[model samples]
Target chain A: MSSKKIKAQMRVFQELENQLLIQADKLGVKDDYNPIKIKEMEYDALKNHLLSFYSERSNIEYEMQVLGTDKKEVLIKLEKLEIYIKRAERLLDMYKKYFGKVFKTQNEEKEKIEKFLTKSRISVSVGEN
Target chain B: MAYEAPTIAANLSQDKMFSAQKAAYQKLKEEVPKEKQNEGTQQMSSLVWETVEGKDGSKTYKVGMQDTVYLAAASSALAEDEVESLSKNNNLRFRDKTLQVLKNKMVKLAMDTFSHNFFVAELSKMGVGVITFQMGLLGISPAEIEKLMSKAREEKNIAVKNGLAQVASEKALFGIVTGAKIV
Candidate 1:
């Protein structure tokens, strides 16, 4: 490719990358009283943010290869992003597991109490009749 | 006239000479191991002497330590009187060649410094760009982002100032190396 064309393409890629980052900055979790719900929202936002980063990184890598430039700088940024993404993922997983267990236990307890109440009401109706 | 050895050396006692030599040897012993570890690397060693040929076909021995404290004793021994006499002498080709080598080294060093600072400044700017992208992913506050961006700008400004100073020095050194007459 001609140098001028490559330069122009690089400029477009940079602008697109900037837009993606701005979109990510604008991402916010909805206000919720439930901590689990808040975390879930955060996880979704983070997942989308990570997707943007991955796409942007791939685009940069492809362009760098085409332009015959060194990939060291891009690789460094990717490495740092990877570390943060992994930590975020770990936290998300922990919250999911903890909340999932709590909800399961609560549902089981609720079901047992409802069954006992139903049996008691049937016995009371029969006595009244 | 030949460059006469400075008479200051004659005043030094045997004990002082021995002590100086001992100290130099001790320093060499300490530093040689560090240099050995850097062996096979691209780093230049000050202990190594280089020979530069003059335009007049005279050879001069120069070492990187000429600007360092390792040569303090030798530089002190050169004495201002001997240096002035050498400069005034008709057959001072060696002294002129040495001066030329020093000037060349200074110009080269200034150029290197300028390029290094410029590169670092560019890298700092790039780092800020990357961090701006990361702030969104990491959910950093606007206030924090403002602080970080300002700090990055400050760092880049300092590096640019340093680079400009080096460029000015490089120009002056280049003029000296080329024997340009200063007004």
Candidate 2:
């Protein structure tokens, strides 16, 4: 691909990143309760968005390889996408643990509920028997 | 007379051997047909032809490379064509996969932002209702508690509506930027 095209594509990704950052900032300011947490969540969401693109690009690369038709331009594009994705991931990680504690808490709560429901079901089954 | 040692090996033999090798190389070059010679020259103007001796004492002409980048460029062009054809054949697959991933991400974003906000709003309403009830029980005027509850409810409702609007706007922004529908 031409350098101009690559630059244009990079600008698009940058624009997306800017939009996400602006939204995150807005969420932080608006959140009277846990502004930092909300902002971090927004950042994480954006990172995941980029990650999805990274994954899709990877799939494209694999597909291209399988077809025995690797394109230098496509590979370059994927590499560029990876760089942005990594940067986003790093930035989010630097601020917080990057989707660890939040997911852990949610999972823990879910597990607890599941265990409680299982116990209740077992007890009810025993009573019926 | 000064080389009294009588040079152990006469240089004549070495020269004769070199002459023979040169003759053999010339002969081999001649054996290569005129058409083949012209074809090699046409393909690579700066081609360096060399005679290589095998273990069996057979000589063969080998072409050597001078500085050239055309071959690399040609191979790259060929590779590009192959990739273009493959991409064209599987264009639909690629499009489907891209759209599928995009849709999935959109759905996840909706769940993460919109549903979570809605859930929080609902929980806030419930919490406010409980607080008002408790305040009423604690000898606060029932009418005052009711009024506070109504105000809190209204605020929560507006917040929920705002959250929904924000999510809708976000979706619209994504659609505008990417030129793709959220679905």
Candidate 3:
């Protein structure tokens, strides 16, 4: 993906990071806090944040090349850039699917436990609940 | 039942009250399936379930709010399988794909999200959801998460991916600015 897209993705990171930071500051030292207990968020998104920046800069440079600088040879490189963008997106998805389970909460685990325990009565409750 | 004097009743007419109750009853009645008219005895109740995983090397899967919600709303009958996603990171590695069955809802959500070929947008939405949860976990670095996010973003076309990324970023930023999290 272009740096623009990378920047876009980073903005999302920053947004979530910022919100957690705010919540940690908001709740004070005592709340029921089951769903969210430990406040373990890290900053320093700048490194990868810049990856997109570089990508965006490069794409604009590529766009400039296509619209003006070395139009003939750069076309192939441009094609490759587009391909990289597509590839990058695919990789993100695969990773997300593979890795998204990392963020499960206790509530979810508890629910799963509750559901399984309750299934013996599915036939009976199927009409009742 | 001539409820007329109380502030609650003054707020609504008896007809409105009965209509609302009737509507709810009507919906439930539909679920009951009238007197075995041969419409087929479909599922009418929920199976209550409580999942338990082996404490030793239970498979880990990365689940999101969307999946959590589905599982939360899931009847006890389905999703008996155990899955462990990242506590607040990007991947949910599992020793057995048997747990992949739990992801049926998530996969269904993805299919629904991309049902009309919105794969790119669908990927971005999942990314944002995952990233948000990761931020909640202590010690999570955005770079590491981005590395994963970038990889996940690869599933879509460039233009579409870029667009979704930009939009998600903007909304995320908006959430941050407004101090909204835990969705």
Candidate 4:
């Protein structure tokens, strides 16, 4: 990981450490026990919290590893999609060329005029019916 | 019939109260799991400590607060182990780890108490002679105090392997040489 990533990780750990210290403070000295004695219990709870917190962080790291692999797979899939898109674009260009050729044909204008006349006649027939 | 209804309600209430008490007692009696104990030991093993070899070939591991807290939790349940591997060696390891933790804690406490701004101002009022005399009485030199401050800042996790001479003497002055296990 980069230094920036490591620094971000350190900041997260520091935040967790601070939160744990707060929790430890809330576990004020047990009146029944002396300072050292209460501090001992507080220490145990803090340790457990720290252990579990680190455990969660490790789990997150594993997840990040898994996600990283997923990213590579996604990138490969994206490359494949881009290839498919390029092929489709080529097909579209071919269709456009074919349509352009057909439109430029000598009979093309007559064909469209005839079709329009036929459609108009059909509409007139329908009106009559 | 009326008496029977009231008796059943009373019995149910009593049962509920009894179970609540039992649960509270069980919570109090709960022991640290063997798995957690093993995990704690595994964690402690990973920490780097400056090992000091004693005169009698004993070893004391000096470590910072993080290691100390970890080892303290691990060693809390060290005594009741039925496992063969958790023998005298493990106990001694735990003891030494705890002692190192205590030593560091004492060092910090001494620094905070003696070197606070308010305390320094008050000490100055007494005169420079009193300040020198106090250091002499405490048997801790100004250099050692400065070293402790520097080490505390620079070291996140460190141990002075064979660094017992100064620590032992300081412990004597601090009068808290006992191990973590006793505390």
Model 4, residue A121: displacement in angstroms? 99
Over 4 Å off in model 3, which ranges? Answer: A1-50, A53-67, A102-108, A113-129, B1-183
Indicate the residue-level lDDT of B105 in model 4: 44
Model 2: how far is B89 from its true place, Å?
46
Q: DockQ of every model listed?
A: 0.01, 0.01, 0.02, 0.00
Model 1, B1-183: lDDT tens digits are 111111122323323444554566567668767866766674553332222222234333344322343233224234454444444443545434234333332222222222223453344333333333223222334355444434433443454434333433332232223322211
| DockQ-based ranking | 3, 2, 1, 4
Q: For all the candidates, what are their Cα RMSDs to the real structure?
A: 28.3, 37.2, 26.7, 33.1
Q: Which one is best on TM-score? A: 1
| Tens digit of per-residue lDDT, candidate 2, span A82-120 | 765665555556445635766788899999999999888
Pairs with steric clashes in candidate 1 = none
| Candidate lDDT values, in order | 0.42, 0.42, 0.38, 0.38
lDDT (Cα, tens digit) per residue for candidate 1, span A52-96: 657777776776688866668877876765665565455446556
Rank list by TM-score? 1, 2, 3, 4
- Ten residues in a row with the worst lDDT in model 4 chain A? A21-30
Judging by TM-score, tell me the better candidate of 1 and 3.
1
Model 4's alpha-carbon lDDT is: 0.38
Compose the digit string of candidate 4's lDDT tens values, residues B5-43.
111123454345445544644553463354355664553
Residue-level lDDT tens digits of model 3 in A1-129: 355665676576656544433332222211422222221111112123335645865976877767677665666666654554454444344434433454555568888999999886655345554
